[model samples]
Target: MSGRVSHTVDMSVKLGELTLRTPVLTASGTFASGREFADFIDLERLGAVVTKGVSLEPWEGSPSPRIAETPSGMLNSIGLQNPGVEAFCEDDLAWLSSVDVPVIVNVSGHTVLEYVSVIERLEVEPRVDAYEINISCPNVDSGGMAFGTACTPAEEVTRACRAATSRPLIVKLSPNVTDIAEIARAVVASGADGVSLINTLLGMAIDIRTFRPKLARIVGGLSGPAIKPVALRMVWQVAGAVDVPVIGMGGITDTEDAVEFMLAGATAISVGTANFVDPTTVMRVTDGLAEFCRTRSIARVSNLTGAMRT
Candidate 1:
């Protein structure tokens, strides 16, 4: 174990031979709030950026008062509110071009045809580095539960999208599944190059006095430090079950948390909820990892990935 640990990793690891500079990336949705913070963190600094989930049609999203704070984490039902793909490309793609990072476009759809149509439009575009299909979005009531979090449509959705795009395809799995490893293996078998796990866990909160739901939507995806353990466990199981790389997320607030996931077998780590707490987390964590390797004389951060053994 120490022998492998001492070997330098070069900060570049292959996800089926496609190399990434660093394993630290901003989780989709968290890093997808337009380009306001793009200037704060050099977009080029990230391994890859998966934008927020964009729908075919502009969705008003869930009712207002969409968030609530939990002890170790926060609950949100932001819905996949976006300006639609056409608007996103027109206005947002410009900033994307300004950034030198690989933009992994995230697509959300209610049905098979819807998914195909969106990808088809993006397929012709130039700035996209990859596609992260979010199958476990629990906010919207309609297609929110449609594409994923279940076995039936999970494999079907992955197979359909794989046939549609020639670029690298990553299926974002939902922790809501009964046995997440089952779905992870299925995604790899269905032609997905990699998988991102534990898309927010499904949860709810209730107001004490009114005896009503705390949030207007009544339910939302739970994220933050609270879900870290769950995310780590799922990533561990899935990484062992599948051949493809695993991008781990959930309550990752710092470099240590990111290291935990890597040790658990995650090829990459995404900073999600932590972004809300501190917007500069992307650069902070990335720099911290670099420092970590430098101080420890560990040469490459990728060497930390999957360092655990049974």
Candidate 2:
């Protein structure tokens, strides 16, 4: 009975040439290279592990009190803190190579050359299966949201990175843009194989008693359930605009949320803040996707993409 049920639905998804065993991926900056959550959930079960933002050099990041909890979500200004690309390969990549799942490195840099350099360095590493260019990070003072918010810069960065490596390139998009679909088109036209969004909305909070900003950065990126509606809208719009693939993420907390993204035309979905709430959120959503399809008699989960009725 179990064997028959398992074969009833196909959960595999393709993002460009990279094939994921399932459509569920962990959002960058949340899973921390998959090692921390390995004990809580099986790393092999994940469709792919997206590591935290890794720059060409180590980033000191923002000062303390960079995180704040709000009504239905949280704000953080981590500024893409990491041990740099070289150290990351020697340590995180080396360990991740042994795991059975695919590793998608999140590349970060202050310049277009820096982003290209990071990819060039990882090209020789056999463990890296793909690259997620994080041009949409809002916390950093420079190069984060700067490259992603506009078409010219977004295209320039995507074009440079595209020339750097043949590995699957997925550009992470910022929701702060005036028109996210335009940015998506810019990246895709510049040779991006896929695009992931909506990287936290620009948000802020104030400590009423102290009469000071809640976060040291004053304005940080807001994530979690608060942004779900906006995220879904952008995902739908981008998916309709782009021909490659759309990896949707933002406030996804459960199986139904994942389904909503797929129906909105997301080729794959990533779990961000939910991982902090429950380490097993990805696994649960992954399993739930299969069950969701099985019960609906949908032979493949891919069929769910863009299935929403007009």
Candidate 3:
């Protein structure tokens, strides 16, 4: 009886040799901590579910005031908070694999060796279907050596990890750079199968009343609708520059925005900060795409990728 009303669109999308059900995916950090979201959102319906970045060691995250709301977005210095790789393998992966979705595990490290160490461990595990290397973490030890923003460091780490891991590598880029296209091309040259764009723009918000920074970290990465225009523009620019697949994300709060990215040449779209406001956002976005196709008599969502023009 319910099947009559249920309309499932062909959400299949391919990343290199990998295929996804829906082009709509969840971003790394914006994900809910538990597996309970499956019932409400239908994880299987998503193109992919990217877990929060996992590190070689457990992270307590930045001190209090880790997040703040900006004019159109929010700033976060949550500091890549995640259980260590070993802990994730035991506590998270078992349940993550239990889900019907394809899980792309985001791996983070401070140095080339750190990146290699993490992926080497993951290579043996079946829990993660792919890897997204996060090279943008603001460094405290090196006085802030952001890997993705710097072309040299970005290429080095990307090459190191790409060589270490067997899974499809998606190099997540930093929007803090002066030239996003340059870095995107660098990663692809270093052997990345694909690239994920515009990882949080670095920003700060001041508290007028308190006469201090809005967040405890003093600064944070901005996400949400505020960065939508910039993200879309960068996605389009980077898409033109790089030959590999581009996973477009940022300020994607709805399906229309996802379509905008697809037209802009994004092979797939990801939902970031929206998850905090709506836990069922993934399903809503995927369902919205399906409806968009049905109304237009479109047969598959794949045809929508890169359908945009200048």
Best by TM-score: 2
Per-model clash counts, in order, read: 1, 0, 1
Q: What CA root-mean-square deviation does each model show from the true structure?
A: 3.8, 1.4, 2.1
- Give model 3's TM-score versus the native structure: 0.94
Cα error, residue 259 of model 2, in Å, equals 0.3
What lDDT does each candidate get?
Answer: 0.82, 0.93, 0.82
lDDT per residue for candidate 2 within 160-228, as digits (tens), equals 999999999999999998899999999999999999998999999999999999999999999999999
User: What clash pairs does model 2 have?
Assistant: none
Distance (Å) between predicted and true CA of 237, model 1? 0.5
Q: Which stretches of candidate 2 lie over 4 Å from their true place?
A: 1-5
Which runs in model 1 stand beyond 4 Å of their true positions? 1-9
TM-score of every candidate relative to the true structure: 0.93, 0.98, 0.94
Residue-level lDDT tens digits of model 3 in 1-310 = 1232125456688999789877888888888434857656667667888888887878787887888988878888888777888988887788886777788888888778877888988888887899988876552233123788788888999899888876899999888888999999988999999999778888888999989998887878889999999999999999999998899999998889988998898989999998888887877777777777777777877778778755
* Residue 235 error, candidate 1, Å: 0.6
- The CA lDDT at 310 in model 3 is 53
lDDT of 1 by residue, 1-310 (tens): 1222223545555555457767877888887743867667666667877788877778777897889899899999989888888888887776787767777888898787777778888888888778888888998765655667676688898899889988889899988878999888887888899999889988999989999887898989899999999999999999889888899999999988888899899988889999888888877777667767767887777778888877
Worst ten in a row by lDDT for model 2: 1-10
